[model samples]
Target: MEAVLPIEVEIPSMRVLAETELEEAEWAKQRCEQLNLIDEKRLTALCHGQCYQQRMARAFNARVRHREFKPGDLVLRKVLHITPDSRGKFAYKYDGPFVVKEVFSGGAIILSDMDGTENALPVNVDALKKYYP
Candidate 1:
């Protein structure tokens, strides 16, 4: 970084090297030119990376569907593989017919059984689907 410095400034190094007055000025000038070139390259690289990321994000979200359900709506809760209902190969992925007892902020849903008792843990809306049957 010191090599790209615009002014004739003393550069401290672990392996100390002495610099003459004219040599120091020339080195400083070289450093100044290098600095601008490096900055332009850095800016171009950053902008290009950001644009690429945004393009990928747009493509990914293009087919994204939001999980929207109202309070009191019947919905299906997803059954995670960690706690599958059965050990068989044909275990159901979704285990609901649960009623949406309440809708909380930040997409969390309070769920209840057919008998109307709320479940222990509130479920995220994305983990649920509208009950078809």
Candidate 2:
């Protein structure tokens, strides 16, 4: 005796269910591919962003010159604090028509009072801004 579907109706319904399952599998695969494509796009955009950032940094560095102060050159020293209190934050951040007394090979500059008589502390070149007179 062979196993047979006494009701032909059940066989067609099972075939339909199988077809739907196959469709679902195809949908899942396509969705995965789409997700992968999206990830690839994001990766490309990230790489481009990094490249743009590097170019911006290079341009900024190129335009900005490294400070070189010679003796007798007047420069303004950046004041980290104007007062003992936090009120200094709102006040002038830079002070001085100070004169550069000496320049060190280590990027430190010895500043003198405007009268060129008194020597101040050695400060890094970064802290000194050129004074325009």
Q: Model 2, clash count?
A: 0
Q: List clash counts for every candidate, in order.
A: 1, 0
Per-residue lDDT over 2-113 for candidate 1, one digit per residue giving the tens place of the 0 to 100 score: 3634332434222222533346666567566767777888999999999999999999999899878887889988886655447676778788799888888889888999
The TM-score obtained by model 1 is: 0.72
Query: Model 2, range 63-128, lDDT digits (tens) per residue?
Result: 987878898899999986556665644777888889988899999988888776766578988888
> Which candidate's lDDT is highest?
2
RMSD of candidates 1 onward, in order: 6.3, 12.0
lDDT of 2 at 9: 28
Q: TM-scores for all candidates?
A: 0.72, 0.51
Task: State the lDDT at 127 in candidate 1.
Answer: 86
